[model samples]
Each structure stands twice: as C-alpha cells, then as structure tokens.
Target: MGAEVITVSTDTQFVHLAWHRDEKMLEKVRYPMGADPTGDVSMLFGVYDENTGLDLRGTFIINPQGTILNSEVNFYNMGRNIDELMRKFKANLHLSKHENEGCPAKWKEEGDKTLKPSPDLVGRVYEALQ
Candidate 1:
C-alpha cells in the first residue's frame, strides 16, 4: 500500500471544507490534505464521524490501482498495528501472484504455506518451512 500513495482526511465535500471559519488561513494551505473538511474521503472509507464531523482514526491499505484492499477505522486516540497491516498486504500480494494458491491466516511471502485446493504436495511445503 505504501508503494502507492495514501491520503486520509475528514471532509465529505470540498465546499464544506472550503467554508472554514478561518477561510483565509485554510486557503493558504496548498494541499487538499491540509484543507479537506467534513471528511468525505474519510466517509468513503467509513471512518469519518457523522456526529462530530471529523476524520475518524483509520488505516486503509489501498492498492496501486487506487482500490482499497483493507481498512481499519478505529479512533485517533487508539492505536493500530501498522506492522501487521504491512505483513498482510505483502501476503496478499504474494497470493495474488499465484492466483491458484489460497493463503491462510497470518500468511507471509517466504515460508508460509498456501493451499492449491488439491493434493499435489503438502509435505513439500512443510519441508520448505523448515
């Protein structure tokens, strides 16, 4: 997901953020990341809070194609497992390479086992793991 760029914000519409109380101050910001309010982008990923109208804390694993692969929308005060998300994203990439193989829980690229839905060579995987 890092290979691709990721952006998280709290504005649902550009206009909503554009009408900030400090219009002049916010206008000075160059990037949307700096000015987008109401969190439309955040809502797209189900992280924006409707009540408070702010970007909820979230972690989204977006693919290079601009598609969301995984998401974790929790809270700004709470913490997320960035390392684990990276591992999962890598494992998903690995499985995609071999579309026929199915990755199990906690799968990784190198030594993890992948099932092909048939008995071709299960023992071989065990040996590889060792």
Candidate 2:
C-alpha cells in the first residue's frame, strides 16, 4: 500500500507529542498524528460528536483525487480491523483499473474472481464464486 496515513483526534498537538514520546505501542510510529482541538477536521469527516465534544473513531481511505474510497466510523470502545481495511484498499485499487468489475465480499487480492454486474447476475453470484 503506497498510501499516506494520518491519525486525527481532538487532542492538542502537545498531547500527540506526549503519546508519541511515551506510548509503547506508538514507539515506532512514523506517521503524523494530527491534533484537531476544535474538531473542525473531524466535523468535515462527520466523525465529530457534538454532545461529547470529541471525535468518534473514524478511518477514511481517500485517493489522490480527493474522493473518499472507503469510510468507517465506530464507537469509542470499538476498534477497527486491519485485515478488512487492507481488503478494501486492495479492492478499490483493483476496481480503479477494472471499472466494469465488482469485488464480492470474498474478494481479497488480485486474480480473485469478480462479478460483472448485469441482469443475469441477479441470483447467480453463488455460482459465479464457484
């Protein structure tokens, strides 16, 4: 994946610095941790919680063209899965080159079978996967 990763939160920049300095899990982190104290960036992404004055956990995969390829928002306690994100990233990349094709739920990598949407595919997806 040749994509840039940036994590944004409502915390201040100093808080991000402190986390990077002391958090064991982020010891080797190289990506930027954005501080959105005013929640403006989070609001733009529709992840801001007005009642809580915080941001919900959100992950967005935006392409170079500024179009969001994938968006996922979860509660504060719920975390995300890297495997599924990777799958979506791969699917988007594959679909960009094959606009007429559709990646099924089981599609994981290149060369995996894809569906060609049509009236004939209405109830034949199970057969197509086989």
- Which candidate has the highest lDDT of all? 2
Query: Which residue runs does candidate 2 get wrong by more than 4 Å?
Result: none
The digit string of per-residue lDDT tens for model 2 on 68-98 reads 9999999999989989999999999999899
> What clash count goes with each model?
9, 0
lDDT of 1 by residue, 75-98 (tens): 768766757877778876876577
Give per-model TM-scores: 0.60, 0.95
Q: In model 2, state the lDDT of residue 120.
A: 94
Query: In candidate 1, which residue ranges exceed 4 Å CA deviation?
Result: 11-35, 117-130
* Candidate 1 positional error at 26, Å: 22
lDDT of each: 0.64, 0.94
- Structural RMSD, model 2: 1.1
Residue 54 lDDT, candidate 1, scale 0-100: 78
